[model samples]
Target: MQLLRSLLADRDWSQDAVLLSRLQQALLLLRDPAASLDEATWLLVADETAHYLDFRRLRTLEAQLRGCTQDEVRYTRADWQAARTAEAALASHLRHVRFSSYAPEPVPMFRIH
Candidate 1:
């Protein structure tokens, strides 16, 4: 998950549909370690055209993931080490991912008095 962490750490990272989707998956997995990647993918693709949604989207996502939970697996130290190694390896080949035509959500500008 170093790749996910790296993407999240980069302030310049564009919060595009793809990025947001990845974030959602990462968050879901973090919140429920028993959740499988397939479950995350399914929820993200359930509404193919919906790249952005309000917080209510979580409710929708949760509904979709309701049946996909697995019994929590305990992670051994070796498993954690392997995961870290994999993340480090993946981070090496990573490139900045961005959407070509994505227009960011508008932010209100404030002028200092």
Candidate 2:
């Protein structure tokens, strides 16, 4: 998450590379041919796809602004905000998933006794 924040702030090429590097194994798993994940796992991945594409587009925008100006690009503040919002949403979901894993399911009152 920090990496992504730094990326949005600095638009450094290395940050983007680092982000991909950190996610390399997951990416490979996600892209594996003839691979099947359980429904829960696929649901998790499905949730991420939108944010992933949002940042993909944001990354393109970041690439354009990196170390030079690309006037031909039509990027604007509203577009940038949309990307940031998506990233934030993804981060929130990740945090929720991370912590929720540690939470125990509540026992039914009938079963508690």
User: lDDT of all predictions, in order shown?
Assistant: 0.48, 0.55
lDDT of 2 by residue, 24-98 (tens): 434455566776566755564454454544555775767676744433355544566677988889999999998
For residues 7-85, write the lDDT of model 1, one tens digit per residue: 4543433366785767766656766767766674656544322422221233344445664322223323244345557
Can you give the TM-score per candidate against the true fold? Answer: 0.27, 0.31
RMSD of 1: 21.6
List residue ranges in candidate 2 displaced over 4 A: 1-73, 101-104, 108-113
lDDT of 2 at 47: 46
Clashes of each: 0, 0
